[model samples]
Target chain A: MSLINIFSDYTLRTVALGSALLGAISGVIGTYTVLRKQSLVGDAVSHAALPGIGIAFLLTGSKNIEWLLLGAFISGWLSLYIVNSIIKNSKVKYDSALGMILSVFFGLGLVILTYIQKIPDSNQAGLEGFLFGQASTLLKRDVIVMSIVGGAIIIIIALLWKEFKLLSFDPEFCQVSGFPKEKLDLILTTLIVIAIVTGLQTVGVVLMSDMIIAPAVSARQWTDKLSVMVILSSIFGGLSGVIGTIISSSTRNLPTGPVIVVIISAISIISLFIAPGRGIIWRRMRDKKNKKRLNRNIILNSIYNLNIEGNRIQGYSLEDLSISKGDFNFPINTIEKELEKLETLDLVKGKDEKWYITEKGINEIEDFRGRLEE
Target chain B: MNVQIEIQLIAIVVALACSTLGVFLILRKMAMMADAIGHTILFGIVVAFFITHDLNSPLLIIGAALTGTLTVFLVESINKTKLVSEDSSIGLIFPLLFSIGVILISLYAGDVHLDTDAVLLGEIAFAPFNRFVVNGVDIGPSSLYIMGAILIMNIVYVSVFYKELKISTFDPNLAMALGISPGIMHYSLMTLVSLTAVGAFDAVGAILVVAFMVGPPTAAYLLTDDLKDMIFLSGIIGTISVVLGYWTARIFDVAIAGMMAVMVGAIFLLIFLFAPDRGLLSIMRRKKRQKYDFAQISFLMHVINHEGAKDEREELGINTIHEHLGWNKEFVKDIFNNLYKSNLVYIEDDIIRITDKGRDLAISNAEEIVNGI
Candidate 1:
């Protein structure tokens, strides 16, 4: 099918737009989560939201998105509050509290879900889908609501960018400067809660954390500034949404949330390996070049040191140097390779089976030695 | 044995193993790793099934354990990049791997009995029916044997390495200096955690593994400071929750694993609110008592400081005392009345008088506070 035909499908279009908005908003707000090292808290809150959604359905006997999301937001916030209290008041660490809350809430949600499934005429078919999300089954109205929610989250993040940035980079400074650090932290967490609640429909609880982390990490590879990173992350997140939607729609039985997660992870893995200075591949390449230069300098300095008394010893063989420089213990082939490189740089020349230092090599070695002595 | 009894036995064993292993995980701050390993084991099972083509193969357990360790290795590698925090690295790897497993099941194994729902929340009721028979004779349920072995393994692992684990968990640098290899202990403990997690998977499913692993230990942690006591208490708490959870599930006709997990949280909540030293109620009561003590002492000091002053203007009456201390009238009256009843002060009509007991109490209290400082 053509792009036009794909976009013409109502369900596909709704899912694509809904997930796109979800991704963008998650990426934008999740930058703080990633920076503040609260990425897994998103996972906890999302899982914790499940029971609340189930309870909301049981009480209202409806599948209304707004009511379910409201329930999710309240419970998600409650779980976070519990986590904060646990960390502050006890010897339990942060991750343990997060893990404890996550599992207990999700288990409670499972009980509620199983109970709700048994209730007659409950319309709870779609409730289980929240575990892994079912964006492909989203309706146009749901999409509209998600977009509005996503838009509001984006606006809040934008309006408080400076404060959030200050808080992320130097929270102590922000607090010392008389900023309401606690209130700002609450606002940031609430925004994260909003993002997770909104994205719950698209990615589900189990996979929602990836939507927050992958894009922010991928964006972090390409920039140092917070603003640039946030923008790039949102773009990457939105792109993954489009790609995942297209793939899931194309393939039967492939879920949208996991597919989106796979696509975003691919993007992140690619960015981690090949993106400019920060990428692992580039760092490896830079290290290789620096090591090669270091090898050449060591071999050249060793040759200079061998004839320190101005008794010019010409054409020192690779074996002689390897033996004399037992501390470096460089192999014969390694010495030969460095010698070849020195010859190419015109610092040394080879004549019949021996290496001779050129006039330029003498001056360069003297200059390095003078600097070292100084 | 009755299937219900057998199932409850498996739950007890599973809880014992998970709670014991969970103490170490929580101490190492790797509590969330239960969640990570829990989900990643699905990928391991799927891959093992793909390779061996047998869901019942013992290799699946090893495969799951290996993949659980692999998950740890990958999370560490990503963390070493310094590009993302440890939590983000965990967030990054598991979903992608878990998604692959879910997608694989949906695409190819849909017709099989391998339901994602079953993986998340195992059917403990049917666990007994999936029994292990030896040479035409009936043994107990397969889960009972599996969980029994894991429980034994956890017991032995903890006992054998109790000192090393304690030293490493408390101080890795010291362990390293002593050549104890905290890294080896960590990986081995994680492997044990993965093994316990998989053994309990067929009984309590994945997510509740975390609840069992974290909840009981945390409850025990609130009650005791000794590591050995914490382990024993956690085991006791886990067993209680499983028994209570089984009865509740039977009564309510709900998911057994879910009820057990809920029970774990409920027990933790009870301990959190009522434990002797660290419970929330105890903490709040201490604060309340301290506030009362502070108020009483300050009130006594005020009355004593003003009594028999050379300047008549400095004299304090019952009405003037409340204004000077900036306390409410009722509160001041309550304090004054209590002091009067105790013979700490005698309110002579309008002016307050300090008795000998009050002076001795104030002087001794001040000296005690000074010595404390």
Candidate 2:
């Protein structure tokens, strides 16, 4: 489909809208989850929800999205509760608890799914979609349900913004200030569970975590403030959702969830490399420039020091400068190149193959020393 | 052997291999790295498959090990940059690689023998049929042998490097000071984890391999403090889960690997709730007993301090003593009765008094508390 056809196509529109809603909600909640250093919780919760979906189908014997997701929400929350209890009560570490619960819960889900397949007249055709999500199968009603849930989550986040912020940054301070830390934590966790469940239909179990973590991580590279990070993260998430849905829908045999994951991963990688301030490439460039400037200053200062030692306005050959002085070693070509650049800056004067420090060069050396002393 | 026995053997071997290394993983706090490696190795297998065009090629194992090490390298490098936290780095890298693998499978490998469902939810029921043929005779299930070799390899690795792994896990700086490189230990262990994961993947799928790797060890951690006991206990737990899960899956006609993972979780839950020293119930019971003992000590100390005071009558009166101690009347009465039964305190002229035993205990406790011991 072309760009305009994406909006004009009914199935594409529904999938895109549902995916965007899922992405935005997860993005907003993921900011807090990532900030709280619980990024992998989404992975565990999503995996755990698989069993819930199967159990829900078994009990209700229908493919109602609402019932299925409610089942997902409950079980996902239960897994998180179990993980926290295990961490708090035993010698088991957090990652072990997460990995254990995630895999075991998913195993149970698979068992239930296989059992469902065995049942006569079960109509289990669509259940496998939860494994590797089938966004192309999303209908109008699913999008409606997603929006309603997504809207409520956004509103809840807005109402509890201050509490969530305090809880994320400093739970101890929030608790000391008479806030119910446990209850607030439960609320935040529940909100996160809801977000993950809502996105499960779009992204599935295995890749749902990237939806939660990638956008927030990308947005974090661009900004330090919580609000900006949250907003930028949601925008990045929503755009990836729409773009991924479009790409997957246009292609043959491309699963929407993984494609969406690929898009978000690309965005995260690009943000890591190119975002200002914290970007890796920018930091590297800045470091390189600083090193170059430092080298130039060292060469200038050395010329001034050699002239002072000789107690005469004498020039030094490139050979003299290339020799290691006080552990400062530079290649002969590097020394020559730096001298030429310094001469252009009027800091040094080069005649033939020899170099002499100018009056400005001496003043610059004195200024650098004075600054260093202060 | 029968298919049932062969399948169970494969599972048992897979579990043993995973749980043994899992002990080190949890100790080094890299259990989730196992989860990451489990997923990303699929990308490696897919790439290796494309090169060899054969599913049974040994090069796949090398590719998986390399990919697992690469995942660790990338995560650490990203973490070293301080751009993202460690968890986020893990969450970021694996899914991307796994997605590429999934997409590749869907696109080009569609007609191949590779199945995504088999990769994610391995059908161990079919594992027994993949016989390892030697000359003209069959030598049991191929996965059983593969997993058996991997299990022995894990046992040998752990035993050979026990001291190094222990020192590095508990104290990396000390390991470094002792001239053992923790980085080498870390990457080698990661390589081993990937190897075990790939070997187990055919029998238990990608995600359930994590259950095998993490579940038993976590349960064993609750049962013991010694590393040797932990390793032994986790292996035992893994074996029990494999046997029980196989039988249960047979009875219900369900997915065997899934049932095995569930069994692992259930065993871990049981140990978490009922283990002798570290169980939740025992910990709570210990806290309750400590509370009562602390209360009794405070009661004895209070009576001893006021035994010969100017306001002894006002402070030591039975009705007033509860008020002086800032405790409710009923709780104070219960504490006094318990202390009286223990012969630590006595009632004289309706005033509380401390016996010599109580006085001695109170002085020692006070000194210990004041000394911050």
Candidate 3:
């Protein structure tokens, strides 16, 4: 089927739009988490949201999405607060505290969920979806709620962009500037909680961290500027959502959460390998060039030292240099290759099987030595 | 034995093992890696099943080990890039592996007994049903034995390598300088963590495995400063949590694993508030006590100075004491009451007199203050 046909489908469109909104906001909010080195904080808060959801259902006696989400928001916020408190008040480190809150809250949530399931008249048919996500079962009303919540989160993030940037980049500077750092941190965390809770239904608890991390990681490979990274990350996140929805919709019995995770992971893997400057491929190429230049200089230095020792620059072979500069560990082929480059650069002359360093090579070596000293 | 007894035994063993290993993880600042390994073991099981076409293959352990190492390697590799921090690297790798397992389950074997739900919410109550029978004799619960052996392995590993583990955990550079390979120790520990996590997860589930790994050790951390004491205390704390958790589960008839996790958290909570020196209440109490002690000493010094002064009008009366000390009436009264109870002061009517002990304390405090100690 054509792309138009897929977008035209009502259920698919709603699911796609909902997930896209979730992805974009999480991606944007996730930048702060990634930059501030609180990436696992997202993971912790999302897991902590589970119990809040279960408790909300038990207390309300209804599985209303709004009440459930409210419960998750409160739970996530409380977990963040607990993590902060543990770090501040005790000797426990940050990661352990995050892990402690995450696992405990999730365990409590499980207990509550099991308890709710045992109740006779409970309408908990879809509550378990929050564990691994059941985006395929999303209703139009659910999509509407997600859009509203996610939209508000993104708008708030946009409004507080400068403060968020300053907070993420230099919290000490923010404090020195008397910027209400604690309040800003609370606001940022609350926004992350809202984003996590909203996305919980679509991607579930286990895969939600991927939704937050993958887009930001992918965008980071392509840019250094925070503004550009933010824009790119959101686009990557939104694109992954749309792509994952389309693929899952076309496939039979495929869930959306894992599919979305897979799609975003692919985007990040590609970005890691092939993006400019920061990419593995580009970096490797630059490293290779630098190594070659260093090798050429080393060979020239070896020849210069040999010339000074015996004034014999005409009959140097690869074996001679290899034995004299054994620390270089240069193989025969590598020595020959560097020598060939030096010959091409008119810094060396080769005749028969021996290589001679020209006056240009001597001058080049002197210039390199002078620059090294300075 | 009954399933309840079997589950309790399994819980104790798993908790002991996880909490023991957790001390190193916490010290190494890699506690979240336990959470990552717990989730990614599902991928290991899935791939093992796919490769062997047998869900119960023992080779699943190898797959688990491979993927667990992969997780550690990936997190370290990402962190080495300096693009992301250690926690971000953990966050980056965990979900990707777990999601792949989910995708595999959904695409190929959703109909089979291989389940994500089972992985997430393992049933300790049903552990006895999956018993190991040898030669027509039931060898009790398989989870019990598996977890028991794992518990022993963890004990042996930590004991045999205690010095190495301690050196590496506390100061890797020192370990390296002393000819110990911190890298090798690290990978070995990660391997052990993966093995213990998978075995424990099969009995108590992933979330509870994390709780046991982190919660008890953290509580122990808050309670002590010595490494050996931390390990010993974590085991004791974990055992206490399991015993209490088992009773709570029975009383409520809730999920045993979840209840155990909650109980572990509760124990940590209590310790966080009441662990003598490092706890919240104790710290606050110490601060308050320090303030009161400082005030009492200052009052003693003031009285000594007043008596030494040439002005006879500076008498040691309650009203004068309050005014001279700049303390409120209630605070002054409390200080005076404490001083009199300790015999550091003699009170006759409205006048206060410093005792010999009080004079000595004031002189020593003056010495300390003058020396700027």
Candidate 4:
């Protein structure tokens, strides 16, 4: 479907609007997620929500998104509670508790989901889709709720942005300075849960986890500053939602959830491999160029050394020293380039018979050898 | 009747595997990877099924386990690069794999009896239907056997390598200095986590695989300090959660596994507010007690410093008040035993006296408190 068609298409618009708002919230919340080093808290809390959703559905016999999502929100909060408790009570770290709560809650969720699947009375066929969200199911009204929640999340993030950043960097310092580190942490966690629960109604479960993580990953690659990371990640998230909608609408059988997921992953990969300082490919290219420059210098120095060895400073064939230089030279053209550079530097003389080292070249070669030995 | 019990046994076996693996994951702080592995295994399960053309074959688990291993590598490699953060790496990798799984399900496995979702998170209530048979006599659920095998492997692995795991977890750099490969230990831990997730998938699905892997350990951690104690407590907590959760579900007529998870969370919240030392109530209690003792000590020192008092007796009546120090009558009684035990004062029936030893000690303590030492 085209752009005009997308506007007219309720399903497409609903999912796009819902996901965009949700993305903004995750981005805003993810600032804290990345800063607090609790970035995986998204997946942890999301997984933590599962068993609760299953329990809610099982108890209520209702498919109402609110009740189920509330259950999820409680579960997510509970995971955070357990994480904090582990950190406080034992010597175990936050990541471990995070890991523990994440797996256990999700495992329990799965078990319940499987059990629910067998229950003849429950019509829970599409419940698994909630694991990886499907924004396509969102109605126009749901989009409105998502946008409101998204707006609120952004506002909350904006208000406590400094406190959150300060607290995340060093809670001890914040506490010493009389800032409420626990309160800030709670606010961040609460906002994250809100973003996640809002997304839950749209994207579902598993993909919701990715959406929370993906924008931050992309944003992190693009910027070092937290403010910039939050903004950039939100933009990527918004783009993924819009793009995912377009793809999902064009294809009949394709759903928006996986398409959105793929788009986000694509953005992450691009950022990972091609973004400025952090990009893998750029660094690799830089490393290769530096090595090439080093090889040229090595060749130039090798010729200068041969001339300074006190052998009449006469023509020495390239074949005479190729093995001695450890075969560092690449090709005939490369050798010619280095020799030309040496001549240009006025460090050598006698072009045709094999270059002779000038006094300047001799001194330089001796210095290079001395430095290498040292 | 027996079949239902066998099905429940399958879940418990998976829980056993998860708890064993969960402890290491908790120790390594990589417990959330169970969620990543659970979701990504969907792709491997689908791919394996397409290749083998049979969903129930052992190849599915093997292929999924392999992918789970690969997922660990992907996440770890990203972690090593120091480019992407840990959570972001996990959030990035698992979704892509899961998306691939979702796509495969849509394009190819949509019509299969065992679809991607089903295979990724099998039916716990129906696991008993897929029973093993030998010589025409029915054995227990195949899942029970699979999970049992995994649980045994994990128990043996953990039991044998507890010291190694403890060493590596607390200080990986130190472990490396002492001739241990932290990387090896880490990958081994992830492997156990992945194996647990895969084995549990047939009975508990992906999320519970995560829940079982993380919940018990976290709760246990909240209640204990020692690692050895944490593991044992976590195992007990896991089994208790399973049993209690099942009962709650039965009583409430709801989902058993979900109730179990909620129960785990419930127990955790209770312990969070009540456990000793770091617990909310305990910390408050300690603070209140410290303040009360501080006030009492201050009063006792004040009474001893009143040099003009000529009372020969050591007892301070309940009504006695050092009004010049602006003290209350009740505080003298409060400080009586405390000051006497420290030998800072001698109390008779109706008056109190500062002895030579008591006076000297009181002066030193008063100076320390006044100097803020």
Best candidate, TM-score-wise? 2
lDDT of 4 by residue, A209-313 (tens): 778888888888878888888889889888888888787778766767788889988988899889997799988999998876676567657766665574764
lDDT of 2 at B331: 94
Q: Write the per-residue lDDT of candidate 3 for residues A1-374, one digit (tens) a residue.
A: 44795567888888888788778888888877888877887899889999899989989988778999999999999999999988998879998998888999999988888888889878788999999988877778888898787778778888988889999999999999989999999898888888888899989987897788888888988998999998899899988888888888887868899889889989988988899998888988999999889999999889888887865745687888888753687888888898999999999888888878889998999999999999
TM-score of chain B taken alone, every candidate: 0.94, 0.95, 0.88, 0.80
Ranking 2 against 3 by DockQ, winner = 2
- Would you estimate the TM-scores of all the predictions? 0.92, 0.96, 0.89, 0.81
Error of 4 at B227 (Å): 6.2
CA-lDDT, candidates in order: 0.86, 0.90, 0.85, 0.73
Best-to-worst DockQ order: 2, 1, 3, 4
**Poorest lDDT segment (10 consecutive residues) of candidate 1 chain B:** B310-319
**Cα lDDT, model 4, residue A238:** 84
Q: Candidate 3: which stretches are off by over 4 Å?
A: A300-336, A346-370, B52-56, B297-363, B366-373
Displacement of the residue A318 alpha carbon in candidate 1, Å: 6.4
Q: Give the per-residue lDDT digits (tens) of candidate 3, residues B1-373.
A: 7667777888899999998899999999888999999899888877887777754445776677678888999989988876666777788788888988888887886555677888777887877777788999998877778788888999999999999999999999999999999999999999989888888767788667899999899999998889999999999999998888888888887888888889989999999998778889999999999898889898888777776455424567767778777779899889888888988988666567789999998899878878996
Tens digits of lDDT, candidate 4, B1-373: 4865675667677766787777767666776677788788877877877788765577777777888889989987887778877777887798898887877777654565556556555557677888678899887777777888888988888889888888998898889999989888878877767766776776766655677777777667767768878777877877777777777666655556666666776776677678877667887789889887676666666666554555422223334454544666566555666767877676555566667876676577677888995
Each candidate's interface RMSD (Å, one decimal) is 1.0, 0.6, 1.1, 3.6
Pick the lDDT winner.
2
Candidate number that wins on TM-score, 1 or 3: 1
* Regions of candidate 1 where Cα sits further than 4 Å from its true position: A1-4, A302-333, A346-374, B295-318, B321-373
Q: For model 2, report DockQ.
A: 0.88
The true-versus-predicted C-alpha distance at residue A43 of model 2, in Å, is 0.9
Count of backbone clashes for each model?
A: 0, 0, 0, 34
Runs in model 2 deviating more than 4 A are: A307-325, A351-354, B308-314
